[model samples]
Target: MSEKILNLYLVIDNGIIEEFRACSYEVAGSDEEKISFLKKNAANDFLSSFKFDPPVSNSGKKMKYKQFSRLEKQGKQFLLFEEIFQKFQVPDSPLICLTPVVDGEILSSN
Candidate 1:
């Protein structure tokens, strides 16, 4: 089956898209569950930049590591940040990477 997605209409801010999106997965659906999933994934991605060590012999020292409890807490907080953005819609800032999509996938950024 094809993957689902969240259709978010966001107001651009600064130079960002000002929308909900997952790191690797596409945001699918307009419901709270989908939005929350996107936020959670984004937070995980944001927190993934702080890894410094490898967990096991096979596992490499990838940036996306959840090592500490504090990191988990930070991830949760990052997910909640969407509320702030939703409350204050961004002003008329130019969208840099806005691209058209024929199917569920994005066409291109250029």
Candidate 2:
């Protein structure tokens, strides 16, 4: 039997952010499609309410590059919530509020 792996990711840009729940099943063979569906729907849902591109990335590069960046497309690297908060130094500011994100899930079978 083949092993299964799951990954959850988030993206933020231009003051807009999105969270996604992703899963992969060895029998399903639909991880890419699932991630794409979630991202597309999430993007469409937020488009009317916010100005930002959907979170999409290819997490399988040796050098770790953004997969969706093209001449006609805009893409960015996905980071964890703490990474974003640390990079932006939101913790030092008293006025900034940081919320805990425990929505990540990974189910693997080997």
Which parts of model 1 are misplaced by more than 4 Å?
Answer: 1-22, 26-30, 47-110
The best candidate by lDDT is 1
Q: After superposition, how far is residue 77 of candidate 1 from its true place, in Å?
A: 25
**TM-score for all predictions?**
0.21, 0.20
- In the predicted model 2, the residue pairs found to clash are none
**Tens digits of lDDT, candidate 1, 1-110:** 21343222222233222233322234344455554664444333432322112122245332222232244466442332244333333222211121222223443322
Residue 57 lDDT (model 2): 43
Clashes of each: 5, 0
lDDT of residue 39 for candidate 2:
41
Per-residue lDDT of model 2, residues 66-86, tens digit only: 332332144122333234334
Query: After superposing candidate 2, which stretches have Cα over 4 Å from the reference?
Result: 1-29, 47-80, 83-110
